[model samples]
Target chain A: MRLALLAAAFCALAVPALAQTSRPEPGPLTIAKQGSFFIGGREVKSDTLSTLPNFDAAGTITVDQMYVRYQAPAGQTGVPITLIHGCCLTGKTWETTPDGRMGWDEYFLRQGHPVYVIDQVWRGRSATDPSTINAVRTGKKPVDQLPTVFSAGHEGAWAIFRFGHQYPQVLPGMRFPLAAQAEFWKQMVADSAANLPTPNPTVPALSELAQKIGGTVLMSHSQSGIYPFQTAALSTQGVAGIISIEPAACPDPTADLGPYKAVPILVLFGDYVDEFPRWAPRLKSCRAFAAAVSAAGGKAEVLALPEIGIKGNSHMLMQDDNSLYIADILLRWIGKNVTATR
Target chain B: MRLALLAAAFCALAVPALAQTSRPEPGPLTIAKQGSFFIGGREVKSDTLSTLPNFDAAGTITVDQMYVRYQAPAGQTGVPITLIHGCCLTGKTWETTPDGRMGWDEYFLRQGHPVYVIDQVWRGRSATDPSTINAVRTGKKPVDQLPTVFSAGHEGAWAIFRFGHQYPQVLPGMRFPLAAQAEFWKQMVADSAANLPTPNPTVPALSELAQKIGGTVLMSHSQSGIYPFQTAALSTQGVAGIISIEPAACPDPTADLGPYKAVPILVLFGDYVDEFPRWAPRLKSCRAFAAAVSAAGGKAEVLALPEIGIKGNSHMLMQDDNSLYIADILLRWIGKNVTATR
Candidate 1:
C-alpha cells in the first residue's frame, strides 16, 4: 500500500521543480508529496551528506540538518553532538592543538566522540568564509574577507599610529581596536593551520548534515556554546545536551530550561578558574545562569577553579597554566554525566 | 528546468519519505553518484537524548525522548541552554544546594543557554518512565537495564555477595569475586537506583542517533562518558568533541576505542581521580591511550584531580562543592584551548 501511494504521487507530478537553499511559501502545499531530491539520472541513494545540502536549499532550515557523527550500541544508539567554538575560535580547538593531534582531541577520539570544528564568521579559517556580512566584500583573501569596518573610518589606534592608517570611512561608531581585530586574526590563523572549521549559525547547513550523523550533542567553548543554546531554543528539533566550557552569552528562559525537555545535561569546570578574583562577576553571572537552568529541571553545576597560585589566574579556568586540570574535568563530565536514564 | 525535474521525479514517486532520517541504500548493482559524505553535510549541531534507537526511524519514540516546552527568553533569542542529569542526583542539587548553580546551565541560558536535566538509567524520574531502561527490569520498579562488562567473567564481591546479583552467565575468564556484581550495583544505587544498559558493539545504534541530532558533542561523566568514547572511535561519520569528567572506567584503547577522527576530544579528572589507587593501571592505560590518539592527529588530554583541598576527592565534580570553580574551567578551556586550535 505504501509503495502504491508513493508511485501514484510520483505519477501525478510528472515534472519536478528546480530549487536551492532559498524557497518561497505557496498556497495549499503538501510537503509529503513534494518533489524529493535526486542527483544525476539515478535516484539519490540516500540523504548522504553530499546530497543533503541541496535539500536544505529546498526550504527553510531545520535543526536536524547539522551533521555531527554518532555510532550506536545494540540497544543504545548514540545521537549527534556538536562542538561550537568561542569568539574568534574555530571548532577544532575542541580537539587537538595547532600542531596536529593534542591531548583533548585525542581524549575525545579515544573515548569515541566526533568533533565538529567550525569557524565563526570573520574568524579563523572563516576569515575568508562567506556570511551575510562578508557577502558584499566577496573578493579574494584578507582584503575581501576583512570586515568592512576595517576599511572604513574605523581604523584602530595601531592602524592609525603604526602604518599611518586612517579611518576616514566618514561613518560614526564603526571604529574598533586594531588589537582586538588582530587578536581575532591570530586565533583564526592558529585554528586554520590546524584544520579547524569555523563555527557559524549555519543552522540550515547543519540540518542537512544531521541526516548523515545519527544524533548530535552541542559542545561549545567560550562564545560558541552560545550557538547551540540558541539553536536548541529556537527549534523544536534542536541539539541534545551541551558541554559548555566558559561559553559566553545565552538567553534566559521565561519558563526555564526544563522544557528543552529532559535533556541529560552536565555543566562542569575547574575550581581554580572560578575562585580567581578577576572573574568574580563572571562567576556570579555564570552561577546565577546555571541555577536558572537547574531550577527548570536541567542539570547544571560549576567546578571550583584551582588556587590563584596553583594555576595562573589567566583569562579562564581551562586556559593559562593548569591546562591539564581543566581537561580532566571536561573529560570526566562526558564520561560519567551524559546518558539516558531509565 | 529544476521545477520540471522535480515534477518528473515527484510524478514517479508519491508520498515522499516524510522525516526519514536517511534514504535506504540502493542495491550494489546501482552505481553511486556522489563520492562520499566528505565535505557535504558539515554543521555544528550537537544533539542528545532520543527514545528512538535510530535516526532513520521516522517514528519518534516519545517514551524515552526529552519532553521540552520552549519558553520566552529573558534576554536575546530565547535560545536557552539546559543541563542533563547523570546517574545519581536531581537537578535541584545543582542549583540550590549548599553550593550553587555555578552558572553552569543558567550562565549560558542566561546569556542564552537554558539549563535542562535528565535522570540516569534506573535513577530518579527516568527510573519510573516506562519507556526507558526502567521498563526492562523485573520488580515493582522492575530493574530492567544492566551494565556493560568489558571483562567477560570479571565478577567482584559486590555482584555475588553485597547486592547478591545472580548472572545468567558469566564471561569466559577473569573473575573478581562472587560479590562483584552485587557490590557494584549497590554502590551505583547509593542515591540513585541500580540499572545499566546492555552492552553491545554500539556502533550502528550510535551512528543512527548521531544522524538525528545532526551530529553534536557528548559531554558526559562517570561511566556514561565511556559510551561517547566508544561511539566516536567507531562512528561511521565523524562526531564533534567529547568532554568526560571523572569517568567510571577508562577502557584501554588497545581493548577498543576505534579511529582517531571526528572532532577534538578532552578527557579530564581531578588529581585525586588520577591518583585513584584502585585504577592506577586504568589511568595509566588512559594516558597511554590518549597519547596514542594524540599521535594519530587527534587531540587528547588528561587532567588530574584538583590539587587543593578546597575541591577534594569526589566522583561528581559538578554536584559537590567547588561547583563554581569547575564551571569557570569549562568556559575557559572551550574558549581558549578548543577555539584557539583545532
Candidate 2:
C-alpha cells in the first residue's frame, strides 16, 4: 500500500514537470550600457530623381553597411562575444527566442560577457539599394536583369533547419519547440547574398568590427559559419576565437591554415545531421576542416552534440528548449580556450 | 546643527537620484506566448537565370512582404496594439530603447495588451527583390536607370528627428538622450520607398494584418504616422483605434472624413515643433486635419505635448528619457477613448 501511494505521488509530480510548456520567469536584467551602431559602408551617388517616386532620393546613398547592437553587463569580467546570424535571419536570432525564452544574448550577458549581435551586410538592418529593381520596373532596365534574392519555402527550411526530413513532420526527440513552429518560420527573411560581390561585403565588415571592438570572440551559425574563418584569414587583428554552429560550409581543408593556428576555433553541430542529406555532407566537411586545423598545429575542436550526450538539438541550437544547457558547454570551452587578448 | 545635518542628508539622498543615468532594474517579465510571421507579398517570376549571379534566382521570388513580431501577456485584458515604425526604421522602434530602458511594447504587454510590431513592406525583415540592382551592376541595364534608394544622413536625421535644429546642435531643451546620439543614428537604414508603388504596399498589408488579428489598435510614429489613417480609410474592418505620433503628413482635410467618423483617432505631437521651420508647418497641417475630422462628426484629438505641460520632447517620443511618463499619458487616452470591439 505504501509503495502504491509513493508511485502515485511520483507520477503526479513528474508528469506536470515534464509537460509544462512555460519557461521559468527570467530574473531582472540590469546592464551597464546597451546601444547600436552602423559600420563599413560606402557612399553610392545617384542622379535619377526624375525616375524615383520619393523626393528624398537622388543623392549620395550609403550601401553595404552592417548594423550591430550590443549589451554590456556592469563590471564585466568575461571577454566580449559578437554573434552573427545564419541565412534568411537577422540578429533577432540571438534575441528573445520564438517561444519567449531568454535568448543566448541575455544568457551570455548574465554570465558576465558583453554580447554584440549583428545583421549581416545587405540583410536585416544592413542597408541594400533598390535602384536597379526600380529601373527594371520602369522599363529602363530589362526584366532579365533582375537580381536574384532568396526566401526559403517552408518545406526547404524544414529540411534545412533539421526540424524533420520534411515539412509538418517532427524528427522524434528533436529539441526544437515544435509547437512554436509558426514562430520559427517568421524568422526567415529575404536574403540578397546573390547580389553581393565575391567574398561578400560582410566578411570585411566583420573584420573591421572585430578591430573596432578591440577584440571579440566571433560566433556564427549556418550561412555565416565560414565568415569568422574568412575574416581571420583576411586579418587576425581582433579575431580572438571562432565559434561556428551548424554552418552550411567551413574553410577549405587544403587552404592555408596558418591564420587559424593562433586563434582557437570551435565547430559545433546539432543532432539529426545524419538524417538530412544536405547537412550530413556539410558536417563531414566541417569535421575535416577541424582536423586540418589540428594537423596544422591549430587549436580546433569539433563538437557534435550527440557525441557529448547532449542530444536532440535542431539547427537552431541556440533557440532550442535546452539552449542554456548547450550554452553552458560553450561557456566552459570559452573559459578554457579564449583568453581576453584585450 | 540639527538643521544643517538634515539638509546634508537630503542632498546625499536626492543628488544621486537626480543625476543617476541608469534606469531601475526591469521587473521579471512573464508572457503567455510570443511569435512572428510574414504577410502580404507577391512572387515575382524571372526566367533569366543565366544572367543572374546565383542559382537561387531563376524561380518565383516573393517580394514586398511585411514582417510582424508579437507578444501576448497571460490573460490579456487590454486591446491588441500594432506598432508601425517610420521612415528608415523597422519594427525595432517599439523595442527596448538604445539607452537600455524598457520599451513600450513590453510596457503595454505588462499592462495586459497583446502587442504586434511590424516592419513595413520593403523594409527591415520585409523582402525586397534585388534582381534589378544586380542586372544594372552587371551592365545588363543602364547605370542611369538605377533605382533610387534613400538612407538618412546623421546630420539630416538629427534635424528631421527633432533632436536639434541642425546637425551637432541641440534644441536647447530637447529630451533625446544626447549621450546616446550615436546609437540613435544607428536606427537609420537604407529605405527603398522610391521603388514601391503609390500608396505603398505596406498600406494593404497592415489592413490585412488588422483583419487577421480580428480587432486591434494601430499605433504609428513619425514616417508611419499616416499609415493608420490610410489603412482606416481603405477599410475600418478591424481598426479599434488610431494613435499617430508626430507623423510627417496627415490625410488631406478635404479628403473623405466619412471613414474616420466611427473610429477614434489620436494625433499626438512632441515639443519644439513650433521652433522648427519644417515641423511647424507639418504640425499645423495635422491640426487642420484633426479639426476637419471633428467638424465632419469624427472623433479626433490633436495633442501637442507642450500644451499639456510635458516639455523637452524630441520627435522620437517613444524613446526619450521620460518615455514612460509620456506612455502613461497615452495609456490614459487609450483607456478613455478606445473600447475593445472584440
lDDT of 1 by residue, A1-342 (tens): 523533442233222222111223212111110000100111111111111111111111111111121112222223335555553233334432322213243233323455444334322212221121112222222222222211101132212111222332321212122232322122221111112233343433443333334345666665454555555555424444666665454445354465344544444333333333433444556566666776776766543333211222223233222344455445555555565221
Which stretches in model 1 have alpha-carbon errors above 4 Å? A1-81, A98-103, A121-186, A189-200, A203-212, A235-238, A253-255, A268-279, A307-310, A313-325, A340-342, B1-342
For all candidates in order, the CA lDDT equals 0.34, 0.76
Model 1 CA lDDT for position B54: 19
What does DockQ give for each predicted structure?
0.01, 0.15
TM-scores, all candidates, are 0.31, 0.71
**Candidate 2 Cα deviation (angstroms), residue B46:** 3.3
Question: What TM-score does prediction 2 earn?
Answer: 0.71
Residue A178's lDDT within candidate 1 is 27
Query: C-alpha displacement of B311 in model 1, angstroms?
Result: 67
Quick one: best lDDT, which candidate? 2
